[model samples]
Target chain A: MITAERKPLDEIIAMILPFKKVLVVGCASCVGECAAGGEKEVGLLGSALRMDARMTTKELETREMTLERQCVYEFIDRLTGLIDQYDAVLSLACGAGVQAVAEVFPNIPILPALNTSFLGQTKEAGLWLENCRGCGDCRLHLFADICPVTRCAKQIFNGPCGGSQDGKCEVNPETPCAWHLIVTRLEDRNQLDLLEEVYAPADWSKKEGAGPRKIVREDQQN
Target chain B: MKIESQLKNVLAAGRFAVTAECGPPKGADPEAVIKKGRILKGYVDSVNVTDNQTGVVRLSSLAACVLLLQEGLDPVLQMVVRDRNRIALQSDLLGASTLGIRNVLCLSGDHQSFGNQTQAIGVFDLDSIQLIQTVRRMRDEGQIIGGEAVSPPPYLFIGAAANPFADPFFYRVIRLAKKVKAGTEFIQTQCIYNLDRFKEWMSQVRDRGLHEKVYILGGITPLKSAKMAEYIKNQVAGMDIPEPLIRRMKSVPAKGQRKEGIKISIETIQALKEMEGVHGVHIMAIEWEEAVPQVVEQAGLMPRPTV
Candidate 1:
């Protein structure tokens, strides 16, 4: 899932300095799973903003609302009549959700409360690790299911790099070297020869380079 | 022979080759490299000029190799893919070759986090295996990675590093074979303290008939002190210094431990010479290049083999 984290409290407070009325919008998807921007986080941020307004003797009217999925038009349409009352909408969602809201309501100022991190997996409670780079092409089959493009510190297709010591990446001892795991696991399965040839340089054509990548379902469009 | 390097010639002539390493200075000091070369001169077949080894920035290996050449010492230029993309690596290979460097050792170097700059980016455009293949194509086929032709291609005796003690020990030999299949003419291993494990790895190498395909050099680093021994055993990554060696160093008094370290290194070389599929020994006297002559002399490999 796309992961995100709430921006620093001070930065968010400063972003709303000029606004008298504000809407804190939350997404119940990826950000909620990562605990970065959920309904609870929206309440926490709204309470902090209200406390700041009271302390500074400012007239600040803040309203909190969470959609089932902020990236969807139907869910965003739930706030159709109410969104025009706020000076700005602070979105506690992934970048997609913020952009979706902006596309629907261009008249209102859209502020991002959460910083989109990566497509990641939760290692355990309270810990998230990026597992996919969304390189558009996947070679996880060759690496024994460990994604070297995202897991390896250098994203080396032909590894383990000399810096991989004792199966741990030199960049961080806590992180396991992706190739070490790939090689050993492949060896165990009696398929060590799979990594013999040099992997061609990654094809950049499939990547989301300068613009947003979109896939059109031509068969379903009609 | 495919490449005419002293080390390659000595290895091909069915003689045991002795190689040493000399790290470039962290500052602009060619004199320091020359001084180290003088000590290594006539004592080893080739001296490896480390390329920002251990991710610590120093004088460029290409420049250091040139300085070693000026001092009449053959330099095996070590090039790592940690800092350069394919464009830089290919151009650097050509530049080093134009400057009369005949030997090259390609590797995916130590991570930048371990160096002075912890936040540096690593550009491993090609790992060691691919780097070896790239050099071979440039030499044998006059082409770059994708077989694009180059005018007057660089001819170099390619070398790659192997870690027999790395995890999943069974795959170590397979990795060596992959590197050999990638077109490396020679192989140098990580520093050795346990001869038994190295012998096991060599047995695996020989079983695969790789002995006849490439020259395998066993790496040996002389311990400077018992503290260094403990540090290597406990702290250094991928190096497997045996407990007995550490005990032997600790058993001795502080003054005599360096000698003991050299003694153990000599014993390892003597044993490695007899081991099947082992072609030579690479004496990595880290920061202790002056001890090269002493170690070579004591190892009975003195007055190094002539090409």
Candidate 2:
């Protein structure tokens, strides 16, 4: 899930302060799951904004709309005719959705109403914690299903660093040492011998720094 | 005294009764819900058990409230008409009454797009005002929506929400009036961080005699850290943190600032308690329920009012 938190009420108010007619757009995908840019948040934000505007003696004509997935072109096309109805759009989607909206409606200003945090899972209900960095490489197989790129303090690719103490990271005691977790998992699976294999430095070319990556599936392509 | 009798006395005495909200658990675990109910039992006259709050699936508020009632706590079963139609709402209401749940907070819940189940469809057959009216019809007229005489209509202390800080401030007062007209006996507003603005709204309510008809509870939540304060300020709608308060939050070092957060919360409660037209503080510590007792104590309020 794309974890996002609501943008500050004042910041949101300032973003749409100049607009009379505004549409609060909610994404029904990742942001929604994180409870940030979902329909409920849209209503809450819209209602809160409306209340704030009323308190300020300003009249705001606010309407709310939620798409199945804001990142998809098909969903973006849903707002084609409705584009001109609002002065601006407060997109409650993730960064991807916001960009998608901006790409589709070049004329309208698309404002993000949420701060896209990171790729995370719900640790518990109403609580989501980050777990992945999307480093564009799948090294979980090499590390017994743990991604050192995200869990490690220094993003170490090999064995535990000196900062690792008793299976806990020294930088933050609450966080477990990623290498320790890897070692424990490898030991459990009887694959501790894999630790002997020295992996080369990560190839940055195949990662995000190389630019936008693409996957072409001949079976699915027209 | 029973909450109803106390409420009546408070009303006659021209004082406001305080109420707070508690969202039910998302799963079968009732520990959090039970603890919240117990924590708020004597501190608040009524605790609102939100029904699948924000459209998120949870243990039914009715069931949670039943447990609270068993513990000798007053539970206000918050029914969101967004998911349930008239039939289900009425059935739940009558069922609650039969189970001795006397308070209810009617809301048009968050749309299904906000919950774990995005494909879920919303059933907003009635908005909050309409739900209040429906409850009133059932209570006062002893008639259901179908006009059939309900053998015994449920008597409930109905509550609703008012966002004084909602944009277009004029509409806030207008909405409150509408809710009152529709049968809201009490209103628990969104978080109150901007007391000046809240006071202005209260003055308007007072001038319009709206305060006379309904008790108002101020919603408050303590910031656990500067980051949390920033989050609430930026992300949480209907929540406003003044610059001074923000500065105070920021002054505390990140490592050991939880104590500072508690102090800030205590101060907020103390200030809110002294504010005119502010009946009581609804401490929404969110996950910080343990600090509520200290806040109430610091604010010089008895955990339970002797009156």
Candidate 3:
């Protein structure tokens, strides 16, 4: 899922400084699962801003709205009627959510309250580990279900680079070496010989095209 | 005539190849590069010009390679993936090649956290292995990394770094084999202080018959002082300095430590020269350039082979 973390208070404050009234938008999808931009987070941010406004010379009004999923137009339509009451929207979803709000209401400004971190999974409460690079080519089957593309620092399929120690990465000693995990898993699966087979350099054309990515299903479109 | 570099020629002729590192000074003084190049001129076959080795900003490795060329020293332009995306790295590879730099060492550089500026963003668009294949494609197939063909291609003899002491030691040689498979012609290992571990690594390399496929250059950096030895053994990552070596450095008084360092380096080089699958010695006399000639002469590698 697309994961993100809330922006710092000062940065968020600066984003909504020009607006006298703002809607704190939240999503119930990936960002909600990460606890970064859920309904609870929207209430906390709205309360914090309201409290901060009480201390300042200018009075600021904040409204809270949580959508089922902020990335879709149908869910985002929940704000169409109430959006005119506020000057701007402070979206607490991933980057996609901010765009969704802007696209739904083109006249109102949409400010992202969280920085989208990565395509990842929550390992435990408050702990998220990146698991995908969206390289468009998923070769996890070849490597015992481990994604070296996202975990390895260099993103080289032929690695563990020389700095890998005790199955830990040289870049961050705390992080496990992605290739080590792959190799050990392969060994356990009696596929050690697969390590000898070299892989071609990743093709960026399919992974990163000239612009943004798109997937349109003609069957589902109609 | 098909060979593009003197280092390649030495390796092709089956002679013990000698290469050392020359870090471009942080400041804008070309004289320092020239001085270091001259000191290592006849002592080593090729000098590796480091590209912001620890990520602390220095003279660009590309520019330093050009300066070393003016000094009549064969410069092995060391490029790290830590600082460049595919566009910049490939463009620099072509630029360095056209500027007469023949030998290129592809490396995934040290983490930026180790450098002076900790806030820098690392651009590891392609790791060392992929960089090797990318350069190979450009040189051999006249194609860019994006699969676009170009009129003129850059010719280069590619090299990559290896570390025998790094953990999961069983996989070091496997990784080396992988790099060789990725088109790396030569391999310069991380500094060798623990000979037993390095020998163990070489045995694995022999078992896989990787030494025959690629020229393996053992890295040797003389320990200047006991503090340096301790710092390397404890502080440095991916190094394997045994407790005995560290104790030996401490055994010597402060004044005699440099001499002890040189002696240890010479002895290490001699032992490595006799080892099977060991192609040559890459003496990385960091900052002590003057000590290099003496070490090379004393190690009986004085008359470098002129192939």
Candidate 4:
């Protein structure tokens, strides 16, 4: 899922300082699952902002709401009526959600309260691990289901570079060496032959094309 | 005349090859590399110029190789994948070939975090093994990765680095075999302080018959001091400096440590010369180029053969 972390309170406070009233919004999708931009987080942020406003200028007002999903237009449209009451919308959503809200209510100031980190997995309650590079092309099967393109620090194709030691990456000792994991899994399955094959250089245009990427299903389109 | 690799020719003639490293300067200064090259000339076969080794910014390996060539030294262009995509790597290979570089060593370079430029993004678009195959394809097949034909192809001796001391030790030999299969003609291993583990890796290479498929050069870096040994053992990733070697270095007084380092290097060279499947010794006298001639001569590897 697309993970995000809340922006520093000071940065969020600074963004909404000019406004007399603000809406602290949240998304109940990936950000919600990570406990970053859920309904509870919205209440926490709104309360904090209200407290800061009361202690400081005592001139600002805040209201909190969480949409089912902020990226989609249907869910985002819920804010069309309530958005006019607030001077700015502080979104506790991923970058996509902030952008979607901005597109829906083009006139209002949509400030992001959270920084989208990565497309990651919630490994545990307090940990999120990046598991994808969104390279546009995937070859997980060739590498024993381990994605070197995403996990390996250097993104090596035929690796475990010399820097790999004790199954740990030299870049970050905390991170397990991706190639070691790939080679070990492949070796366990007696599928080491897969590594013997030299992979061609990736065509990066798929991921880094001329501009933004889009997908359309013509059959489902009205 | 098929390929102009002097290192390959020396190994082909069944003579023990001698190679050493020449790191490019941190700044764009030609004399630094030339000075090092001059010291190593007449003492080694094809000095390997490192490519931004340890991710520190330096004069390019290609440019430094040219400088060494000017000093009447055959240079091995060390190309790392850390800072280049396929296009840049192939372009540099072609440029190196055209500039009279006969040898190229492919490496998935040290991570940028270790260097001064810790914030720099690494561009490992292709790893060392894939780089080897890319060179092979460009040279043998006269084509780029996209099947585009070149007007004239490159003729080069390809090499890659191996680390037997790294973890998953059983797979290190397999990785070497993979490199050999990828068309690497020569392999220069990581510095060997743990001879027992290296010999074990060599045995596995022989078991798989990979030793016969490619010429293997044992890496020999002379430790300048006991502190250096300890630092490498503790701080340097992927290096396997056994405890006894550090203790041995410490056994000697501070003034005599350099001499002890040279002595250990010579002993390693002699041992590698006797080991089966070992074709040469790559003396990496890091920042101590003056010691190469002494180590080579004292180890009875002087009077480098001219192939």
Candidate 5:
């Protein structure tokens, strides 16, 4: 899921200062799972904004609401009536969700309260680890399910590089060397022969090399 | 036979070869490279000019190799894939060839975080194996990576690094085989302190008959002091230094440590000379090129072989 962290309180406050009345919107999807832009976080932010207004002697009003999903047009329509009641919409969603809100309410300025991090999994409580680079092409099977493109520091195909030691990466001692894991696991399965063949250079055009990528299924798009 | 490589000829002649490394200075001074090249001129078969070794920015290996060529020494141009994309790598290969560089060593350089520029973004567009293939294609097939025809493709001898001590001990030989399959003609290993492990790696290579397909050069670096030994054993990544080697260094007095280090390196060279499938010894006397000649002579490898 897409993960994010709320921007510092000062940056958010500075962004909302010009608007006397602000609508704080949260998404209950990816951001909610990561506990960054869930309904509870929206409530907390709303109270903090109210406190700032009282301490600064400013006539500011904050109304908090959480949508089932922010990226879908159907769920974003829920804010159509409430958007006009506020000066600006402060979105506590990922970049895609913020853009979706902006598309739905083209006139109202959309502000992002959280910084979208990466496509990752919550490895454990309070720890999120990025597992995918969204490179468009995926070859996880050949590497024993480990993504060298995202995990290896050099993104080396024919590795582990010389910097690998004790199953740890030279870049960071804490991070496990992806190639080491691949080799060791494959050897256990009697599949070490898979690494014998030199991997060819990646066709990066499938990723950002050609520019922003898009896909359209002719049968499902209409 | 594919390229005019003095180092290749020395190895092909079945003579035990000796190679040394020359690191480029940090500043834009040609004198440093020239001085080191002069020191290693007649002592070794070919000199490898390091490419931003340890990720520290320095004079380029290409320019340093050119200086060595001017000093009447055969140079092995070390090219790292960390800072250049395929286009730039190919362009530099052509440039190096045009500048009279005949041998090339391909490597995935040390991570930039280990260098002065910790925040730098490494441009590993192609890994070392792919770089070797690219060079081979350019040299043998006369085609660029994009399949464009070159008017005159670069004729070069390709070399790649191997670490027998790095993790998954069983996979190290397989990695070397992969490099050989990728068109690398020679293999230069990381410095050897644990001779037992290196011999195990070589035994595996011989088991697969990979030694006949590619030349293996064992790496040796003389430790200047016990402190340096400790730093290498603890701080240097992927290094497998036996505790006894450091103990030996500490056993000597402060002033005698340098001589003791040279003696240790000479012993390693002598041991490597008798090992089957071992083509040569690459003494990477890091920052101590002057000690190379004395080490080479003391190892009884002097009166350099002319192929």
Candidate 6:
């Protein structure tokens, strides 16, 4: 689930105040799951905007629309003819969806209503915790499904640093030591021997230093 | 009753208590908060300041409510335990009490995934019912959630939320009953569009003797456009927009649709007021606070009853 907190009502209102007709677009995928840019939120935002506009001099006209997935071109294309109906578009999707809207409708001014945070999973019904960085690499197989890249304060590739205390990270005592989690999981699975493998220093060049990365699936391509 | 005695006296006089909702400013803008407070001042009995509403962070609800208090409005600090554990929730309640914001509406806010940070963890340490009970226990017994006696436990007129139209209506009502048991003095339902269904549920509430225990406030948010109406029907759970209403919204001249939306809301509120167990209506115009006064006036509700 893509978790997003709504930008403050005033900030969002201020951004769209200059526009006459605004489309409050919501994403039915992640933003919907998180409740930020979902259909309900779109209605709530549109209602709020309408109320705000009524209070102001402009008396703006606002509409709401939600797509199945905002990041996909098919969903973005759904708004092709509808784009002209509004002076600007307020995308409730993640950053990717906002960019997708911008890319698809280059002429329309696109504003993001949510600050896209991170790749996470719903621990329960409404809670989403960051679990992945989409680092273009999978090291979880070695670390018992815990990604030190995300959970570790240092993003260390090797064993626990001296800072780990009582299974908690010393950097912030509230945070659990990522290496400790990894060790615990390995120990549970009776794969603690995996920790014996002295891995070389991570090649930063292959990760952050590699710049923008892409994968071309020849099978899926025409 | 101990703390709400004064407000109860006002309610007993057959004067409709006015309650307004103030959505927290998205940013730290005192002007917006103050402006909203001023707009609702003297018109509403109490103003509800929503907490990180819908899991979206704005200015904190407590800060906004405190600001409203400073602005001379009786602010009902809306609290959601979705993001906080009992410890933090109790602390915030204590903080609100110390700040002299008396009224509180406890809610299990929308899932954390609904916000901009989709990956944020939700700490549903306590659901709305438990939260209400916790507040009651603290107030009546002067004890923390762990049963430890606290010096000078805060007194609050704790409120809870319900969705009569939420699917599986029986369960929603059951939960409402649970909330009443947990010490919810007031039950403000989710935005209700279908009055017949609401009336039916209110009848059930009456039958169960739930209405006697708590004041039931029907939630109403006006639909501004056909698209907005459709979103409510398709997306919002426990919310239903009758086809006629949707068709009416669509039939309106493009420019006149907003007026039509307001009309529908007014009719809903008027009809809801006629329901047997319905005490008052909680108008959640979302950002449409301006329309709220108009809706209330059109529905023949006095802006504020004379003391």
A1-222, model 2: which lDDT tens digit per residue?
788888898899998988999989999899888888888989999999989988889989999989999999999999999879889999999888999999999999999998989888899988887788776778789889888767865455544543344467654667787877887788789986666554533544465565787777999968
Clashes of each: 0, 18, 0, 0, 0, 29
Q: After best superposition, candidate 3 residue A68: deviation in angstroms?
A: 0.7
- Winning model by DockQ: 5
DockQ (Cα-based) for each candidate = 0.47, 0.01, 0.52, 0.74, 0.84, 0.01
Each model's lDDT comes to 0.87, 0.76, 0.88, 0.91, 0.92, 0.77
Error of 1 at A122 (Å): 3.4
lDDT of 4 by residue, A1-222 (tens): 999999899999898988998988999999999989999999999999998988896688888999999999999989988899999999999999999999989999999999999988989889999989899889999999988889999888877788888889988999999999999999999998887776777777888777887878999899
Candidate 4 is graded, for docking, as medium
Candidate 5 RMSD computed on C-alpha atoms after optimal superposition onto the true structure: 1.8
Residues B50-154, model 1: lDDT tens digits: 999878989999999999988887889999988998889999999988888999998888878788877788877676777888899899999987678997999
Candidate that scores best on lDDT: 5
- B1-307 per-residue lDDT for model 6 (tens digits): 1234223444556555557789988897999999888876766677888988767879998899889888867777888766787779999999988888788888766656557766787665565666787889899999886679977989678787887664334444555676787788887887877777877888889888998788887887888899999997765544667888899999998789889988988888778777777777777877877877787788888747644
The runs of at least 3 residues in candidate 3 whose Cα sits more than 4 Å from the true structure, single-residue gaps closed, are B1-4, B116-120, B137-153
Between candidates 2 and 4, which one is better according to DockQ? 4
Please provide, for model 3 over A10-57, each residue's C-alpha lDDT reduced to its tens digit, 9 standing for 90 to 100. 899888999998999999899999998999999999998888888786
Q: Please report the candidate that would top TM-score against the real structure.
A: 4
Candidate 5 Cα outliers beyond 4 Å, as residue runs: B1-3
How should the candidates be ordered by TM-score, best one leading? 4, 5, 3, 1, 6, 2
- lDDT of candidate 6 at residue B47, scale 0 to 100: 81
Better of 1 and 4 by TM-score: 4
What global local distance difference test value does model 1 have?
0.87
* Lowest summed lDDT window (length 10), candidate 4 chain B: B1-10
The model with the greater TM-score, 4 or 5, is 4
Model 3 over residues B49-128: C-alpha lDDT tens digits?
A: 99998879999999999998888778899999988888999999889888999999999888788889789877777878
Give i-RMS (Å) per prediction: 2.3, 26.8, 1.8, 1.2, 0.7, 21.6
lDDT of 2 by residue, B1-307 (tens): 1335344345446554555567777788878788888887676656677788656789999999888887777787888865777788899889988888888888766546557777775654555676788899899999887679996898787888777765445435756777787788878877777878888888898888887788777887766788988887765544567787778778878975778877776666677667666666566677666766666666666656545
Which residue segments of model 2 deviate by more than 4 Å? A1-222, B1-16
